[model samples]
Target: MSGKRYRLQKTERLQLKIKLLVAHGSNCWWCEEPFSPDDWPTFEHVNPLSLGGTWSFENLRLTHESCNEMRANHYPISYEVK
Candidate 1:
């Protein structure tokens, strides 16, 4: 199990994304901006995986791809929704 990594399946990821979108709308969790046609939506972990975060729905939020990338693997101190 040391070299093996666990990842969400495509269908599972899609389901989670859809559920998050329906619950939170298309807003980026970090920036609180609605997603535009040019923006790509992605799921971000509130606690980074590097810090032992799980892929559970409660730990995930919707964000822009760019925002997620900017966040990287840092742990979030607080989530301010503007």
Candidate 2:
């Protein structure tokens, strides 16, 4: 991976999008909102690629475009389910 943008081919992008969608559906990772018909889907970086996060399926997630934008590069705080 290079600095700045994490480049991906169209096929790769589509594949990633499909994988994330399957894993998380069309929900917003940050807000837990259901996707709207007019909403666009985007990849939310769990740990933030800018902060040394990998672009792997484990780190990427499906989210509403607006939610991803609002969250920016900030990873959400996780609470233990115990």
Candidate 1's TM-score reads 0.81
TM-score of each: 0.81, 0.74
Please provide, for model 1 over 1-82, each residue's C-alpha lDDT reduced to its tens digit, 9 standing for 90 to 100: 1222268789977887889999888888888889877886898988787888878777889898878888788877643333
Location of the lowest summed lDDT over 10 successive residues in candidate 1: 1-10
Q: Write the per-residue lDDT of candidate 2 for residues 1-82, one digit (tens) a residue.
A: 2333466788988887877778887777666777776886777778888888877777778777766776767657642211
lDDT of each: 0.78, 0.71
After superposition, the stretches of candidate 2 with alpha carbons farther than 4 Å from their true spots are 1-5, 78-82
